[model samples]
Target: MSASTPFVKMNGAGNDFVVVNALERAFTPDAGQVRALADRQTGEGFDQLIAIEPSTTADAFMRVWNADGGAVETCGNALRCVGWMLLQASGSDKVVIDTLGGPTTARRAGPDRITVDMGPPRLDWREIPLAEEMDTRGIELQVGPIDAPVIYTPGAVSMGNPHVVFFTDRLDDAFVTGSGSLIEHHPLFPEGVNVGFAHVLAPDRIRLRVWERGAGLTKACGTGACAALVAASRRGLTGRRAVMVVDGGELDIDWDEASGHVFMTGPVEVERTGTLSL
Candidate 1:
């Protein structure tokens, strides 16, 4: 018999994950293994796979893999889930998490809620890493036709990963899943992009739907919510703070004016626990 590893199934809002404690037992799954594990019918179904590893500079290091078996720089919802785990283990109010993006800090906001300081939003075209130098506030991209495009002039921002937010008057599922998938593979974005469809209800509230780079459409995206707030604020569509209403639940997002750091607060839920044969 092969060895098996203990796993925890967790979700932040509706963004689900299969978490492995690499700190307890060192294990890294290859792309094939990741794909097999991500299979909804055959294995543990999840939007992402998170590995909690030991870190010297922070409480723990979070490694992320999208459902498509691709490694990513960061994931806001996953961060919150990992933060909750670390806080519970250490019995601390706050903890720092290290990732490929950088070091991030998370604090206890309330019961079953965590607030993560996602550092600063990368607004430069180079940082967002577009194919060419263009204004990130409103990139020249459109869907449909050139005369009257379906969605155009999207604001680009990087919350450790590439994203583009298109402000629209209405939020539609067909549009999000269809057009979003097209934009995610646009040539302008060299490394692909997470596409956000945002409808600003008020200066302090926004309704958002995200088509993640490798995860398809998810219930909620933590970094997607943060990027929408920042992009909207930059475009004067909303204030620096807003409540992002997603498919699963709501997230409170605040972009500090002074420090320019974005904070995301949301709830985390533990779904189940099991072991995966390796």
Candidate 2:
């Protein structure tokens, strides 16, 4: 690692992260190394690790890794975090971030508020990396008790990241705790899964909680908000655009009709910055 390279610590809602750039600096963070660094007990840990690199097509490339050190695609919060950092560093308000899944656009809506064009949601089974082919609209998934199910027929959507959504009568921990574990480890999802339990309110608002794949239950998840909107829209549960209230904060989401893309708007907070040595 370089002696004088700068890094940033940022968060979207409450999903905190530690971000560094490989393009501007020089550091290929190994999974073991990343895991070690993000371990709160051992180092300056965080929920996720965001690495920014140079992109041939877009303004930059973004690589996302869970606290467990597994690299994944599309982080709504991380994208906004990157956008905020880019704007602060480059004085530009618009950015395109290329990831392992695809490229996404982030535009600053206002000071501390950023909006991300998260591309389209994939409903197909293969796109979600399900182990077997199944209907994406409503899959025959059940958990908890057989007769009295905790979750049934979850609506699946991929916001670059995999999310399995369960629409509930209300938002509570009972449902989130019972069903989240089963579906996340279900035979179908090869890459594991992020689980969301949503309760619709007035068709224009939703109450949501997320069990992130590797990060466990976080206060909020940006991709989870995007996935919930996609799932609700497909199930005829809500309109294309609505506000989601998570345990940490709120996010505004819109599923575009023409382009079939999902957009998430929220705030990114920078807490502090520091460094650690292995």
Candidate 3:
């Protein structure tokens, strides 16, 4: 932390972040510092902390830290929020962001709306990097009574990060929190996983809740929504496109069959902007 460093508080739907531009300044926050900032009761709490650094390959490089002080590979909502901000500042219709996941492109759609090209979904068992090879469409896992499982046969996908989606008739609260927590740290997922509970409302609409890997439950999870659409499509539960309704807001997801890429469109808002003392 600098004596005084600038930051912007922004949110995509309800997932909030504190973004810092570290292009010209050194702003690497350790675990403790990140934890302090994310403590909702004591500090400027946020779901994640983002650092924007100069990039040689793309418009900028994004570094992210989860609320629990752990770093993550990608965050779709953060990308969209930052992408829109950068696009507005540069007057560019498109911006490329380089992340640990890969280089992703963001395009202007409408007023305060951005569409992110999240690339293709990684469906291979090895790509999800499970402890061992297994069918990703429906991994061999179960919850509840062995005789009659409450949640079983979840689909796994990686949208730059790991996720496991359980398509149920309803978004059961207990299931989302209990089963989600247990499966998030399950040994099968060596890298851990975001747990998603989705209920199909129609062929093109679905309601979803996510227990994020390092952040626990959040208002929304862009990557989780993308993963849900892919997982649903894989299981033949839904078409390639759908609207994912989360707690905060709605997101449009399209899994293009032609290019095999997933595109997510949503709105972003700047909550506040100020300087913080590190």
Candidate 4:
């Protein structure tokens, strides 16, 4: 292992990341290494660690690791940051990024802004892969009590990753963390799930908070935002397009009616460049 490696710290809508160009350095971090780097107090803290690798089918391959050192499928925010980096390097307007989920296209929308075609939402219960068959529009999961649950009938969707969204009028921290943590490990989700607490302000706007499966609560979750919108639309709570207001910032999410593809547009910020002692 190398003593040190260069890294680029970036964020998209406040979902921060530590990006290592494996295409340049050829580095892979094991679970322990990833956990070390995820330490906020002692190491370079980030919601996720992105390794940029070579891909034959796409412009590049993105490997994602959550703060808990779990290797996940896709990360929408990281894709935007990586897309911006690749676009700046190649000076191209569009780029295709391959992930564990599948291939996605990203295009330059404006200064520091990128729009990613995040493919279509997986609607089937088998796709979301719950423990058993059920309706994804509103699952049977509930919090609090069976007769009078605090939150019930959450919608499920897989945006490259598993998520269950609970629509409510309250957006308090306690409800989000408490209920979210409980649902993330629910037996229904065999692979675990990201839990989203969505408060719909209008047909086109929602305030959301997410408890990421492997990363706990984060400031922003790009895929979570997409999942929330899709879930809301399926439940007829909102239309296909909305502005998702997260703790870190806002994301514009549009589920295309023609293509059935979800497009997420957000801003990416280069926080800093540094070296990590591994």
Query: Largest TM-score belongs to which candidate?
Result: 4
Model-by-model lDDT, in order? 0.94, 0.84, 0.92, 0.94
Model 2: weakest 10-residue lDDT segment is 1-10
TM-score of 1: 0.98
Candidate 2 regions exceeding 4 Å error are 2-6, 169-175
- Model 3 Cα RMSD, 1 decimal: 1.0
Stretches of model 3 off by over 4 angstroms after superposition: 170-172
Q: Which TM-score value belongs to model 3? A: 0.98
Taking the tens digit of each residue's C-alpha lDDT, what string does model 2 give over 219-252? 7899899999889988899999999998878999
Cα deviation of 35, candidate 1, in Å: 1.4
Tell me how far the alpha carbon of residue 60 in candidate 2 is from the true structure, in angstroms, after superposition.
0.8
* lDDT (10s digit) by residue, model 3, range 1-278: 56888999999989999999998997988899889889999879999999998999999999999998999999999999989988988998999999998989999989989999999999999998799889999999888899999988889999999999988875667667887889989999999999999999888999999999888889999999999999998878899999999999999999998999999999899999988777
Per-residue error for 156 in candidate 3, Å, reads 0.3
lDDT of 1 by residue, 22-91 (tens): 9867778888888889989998999999999999999999999999999999999999999999999999
The alpha-carbon deviation from the true structure for residue 190 of candidate 4, after best TM-score superposition, in angstroms, is: 0.9
Point out where model 1 deviates above 4 Å.
none
- What are the RMSD figures for all models against the true structure? 1.2, 1.8, 1.0, 0.8
> Which 10 residues in a row give candidate 4 its minimum summed lDDT?
169-178
Tens digit of per-residue lDDT, candidate 4, span 92-153: 88999999999999999999999999999999998997999999999999998778998999
